[model samples]
Target: MLSWVPLLTVALLCWIFSAGQPYGLPIAVWAEDSSSLARQLVRMLDATPGLSVRAQLLSRAEAQQALQRMDVYGVVHIPPHFARDVQRGGAASVTLLHNAQLSTASSLVQRDVRQVVGTLSAGVEMQAMAKRGTPAQALQVRLEPIRTQLVALFNVSTNYEQFLAATLLPALLHILAMTAGAWSVGRELRDGTLGQWLGAPAGEAQAPARPSAAQVLAALLGKLALPLVSLWLCGMAGLVYLSQLRGWAVAGSLAWIALGLLLLIAVSLAAGALLAAGTLSLRQAMSGAGLLSAPAFAFSGVGFPLLAMSGSARTWAEAMPYTHYARLQIEQWQMGAPPAQSLPVIAVLLLATLVLLALATAALLRAWARPQDWGKR
Candidate 1:
């Protein structure tokens, strides 16, 4: 029972963190000269659910200073002629100074500000049309000369959970598979039983029976079997249980997701085998796996766009197995992309697994031939 505490604790924390999405954030408003229309705009901004007019600044300098101090995420600046321009039926503009360092929060603030400005502009236009004897029924149509409706395909509500959970959960499972596979080899070496485990003679015999390449590969695969199976189970749970609970899109067939999960596990296992064979020590193997897998979540393009990354960074991200897996999940679940789109991603994963497996097998065979290399580190 005590052993279950850490696992339960992790599950609890993930649940708590993901339960509520924060859409509304406080913002500062600075309207120069404080005209009636400016005040009305501020009120409208305050009423918006995405933003709260927490502070009314008298000067731009004060707003800038507050932003610098991190006291506010963004500042809305209404110019001196803002009201006069509106009343005269002239074009008016409001500038938003936002903290680009916090991309997500800044985006929310920008969206809310745009919505408020559009509403105010439409109202001013409708009043102007009324003065020209436009009928009341025509006024509404004139206010919105053109109407546009936005429909999000996969995530209807654009929920954060849908975006975050799908990527994060799979990445977490991949890390666990890597750790477990690495630990299996490390434990045998640390216990001074690796030679016996590999069926190779310890020291003494000049030409001890060296295991064939096939045998070496089999040994590594045997160690990985359980971890791979466990990872598959975890993948199924995320698809059937977590997806249903969170209302995440699962447009692709379950068979495709399962196949992708298998490839993901195979990649992790092959990576772990290569690390163990190269390092030849339990501690070093685990350390190497940690270094390789820790940044997978960020590089998977979950929080940011891959196109924005530099060439070198993008190349590195593409090499990660999780990056391919995440892309497949998004296409299948969210976009409901056709098989033509998804098959390429699955093919890439399969190719990676084969390459890594070959490398790991060769490394293990070399380690088996040279008994002195056992626990070399």
Candidate 2:
């Protein structure tokens, strides 16, 4: 039987990453004067993407209390003389109080607030210019000369749920599949059932029971077949249900997702076989496999772009099968890039799968020949 430790670890990691999806980090508003201008500003902030104004606090004390209670990630404080200053053609400022501990949420709040303030300032300046009889074309040219249009592809909103969650699901499955594969083989070795598993002849026969290479391969496949199927199904569930429900732009077809899942399963099974053949006992095999696959999530270009890494780091990341799979996912699913564009990455995944499978086969064959080393610690 497999231990529950690894399963619990995977579950906890999944929950921690997925919980950031819902509110997208809601913010709070504090309109000190309760004036028309202040209310309008609050409304604009509330409507901003990736941020929602959930609380309306009357005082700084109340806003601070909300922050302390974790009711809001940030607070926008509009001063009492904000409207009066604007009417008098004097500069008016609004203060933003944010929880620095939540860096991503705080950064989003700061960016949205800055954009709102800039838009309002531009309008105010344009009105002044109009009052002075400035031409409309001149005002337009002065405000925006280049007029660069930003077309965000794939993830338009850049929602954390869609971007992070999509990549995380497959990476987690890879880890679990690899770990389970190792456990399946390692348990048989530890419990002295490997000979029976491989269908070797009974002991005390003068000639040693030599199972053919095909028989050894079949035994390994039998151990991993269920796990590979289960992981593939989970991958499909995440791609279809979670990803589609989030409104993420999937590729033109499900073929890309299916191909990536198959590659991931192949690599995972290979990793498991290698670990089982190398380790002496079930505990060692499971631990080694866990360590091997755990860091894959970080280095797979999920949170950081591969191009931004140092040359050596980039080369190292490329060596990981997950890195290629991740690249294929972003190119196909997120960027909506054609399969041709992802051919190089797909090639890498295919090559890695083949090479790892070959290595695993050789190692397992050696272990099968020397059954005395199966449970040696």
Candidate 3:
């Protein structure tokens, strides 16, 4: 599962969101007026990338049914005499009934549809004013006295593939890393090889002899080295795929981001090792690993914003290294913060790794000295 699961999941997630943005969403339109103005707005709605006018019904009742059946995202109802209202210098209404359940799609459709209607309304008003002997420049100024430009500082395209997949890959790897670390150390105990592995040299004894704390730590590190290095390489490969092959922008120094990835891996591995050593049972250790890592992404503020969370919930999020790691990745990758700003988070991860490593080493050493605790399934 470890060898290919993360790769497959990450690839699947990327494929799911490969579309840069949501577009061509189906929307229903009902033009009660049957005027040239209503038809023009329908064409404009279809022209926008965010919406597709799937059906133009004869009556409001049919449009409502279409919306109820979910044949389309929403209905654009043009009330009767809409053109006459515009011609008579009176305000007209275009009613949009959208599916609130599909919030994101509904919002996008609403935005595009509103823009189309607003643009046409302005033009219709300007023409009416022009016919009434109003100056064109004065009409334009009166229509939009204070224009504003909305700009997105990061993830400008709002591409879900880049925004989410980039962060999701790390979370997947983190869970796997902790599981691998636990299994690496836990298996020795499960298989009854802890003594022979952590104690005296080959041919020195018939069974095995307990070694010093140094030997115990050495054995634990040596056993974990392979998996640690392998997962770290996997992390680097993911980074390369995202930033180089996929062409996702890396705002800050890639080198700093790489260091952050390394720290995240080390801390997760240490955490797993600590769990296994403390539990002294492979089954229990693996169970604990799952309970901790499985829900990590949710609490890591990847799916939800930390600022929006309750105070106690945010505190729980702060306690997880994945939270800090995620923050570091966003800071360096999306926010393009300087290396200096990233140091504190890096230090937090590094410190967590060290603390977990120390506690795991001590636990392993204790387990090494007690042969009774060696054989655990």
Highest lDDT: give the candidate number: 3
Worst 10 residues of 2 by lDDT: 1-10
**Best of the two (2, 3) by lDDT:** 3
Which is better, 2 or 3, measured by TM-score? 3
Listed in order, each prediction's TM-score against the native is 0.83, 0.80, 0.87
Model 3 TM-score, all chains together: 0.87
Cα deviation in Å at residue 184, candidate 3?
2.1
Number of colliding residue pairs in model 1: 0
> Relative to the true structure, how large is the alpha-carbon lDDT of every model?
0.77, 0.75, 0.83
Show where candidate 3 strays beyond 4 Å. Answer: 57-71, 200-208, 369-377
- What ranking emerges by lDDT with the best candidate at the front? 3, 1, 2
Write the residue-wise lDDT of candidate 3 on 263-349 in tens digits: 887888889999999989989989988988888789988888889999999998898878888888889988999999989999999
Best by TM-score: 3
Comparing 1 and 2 by TM-score, which wins?
1
Give me the displacement of residue 14 in model 1, in angstroms: 5.2
Q: CA lDDT of 82 in candidate 3? A: 93
Task: Give the CA lDDT, 0 to 100, for residue 356 in model 1.
Answer: 81
TM-score (C-alpha) between model 2 and the true structure? 0.80
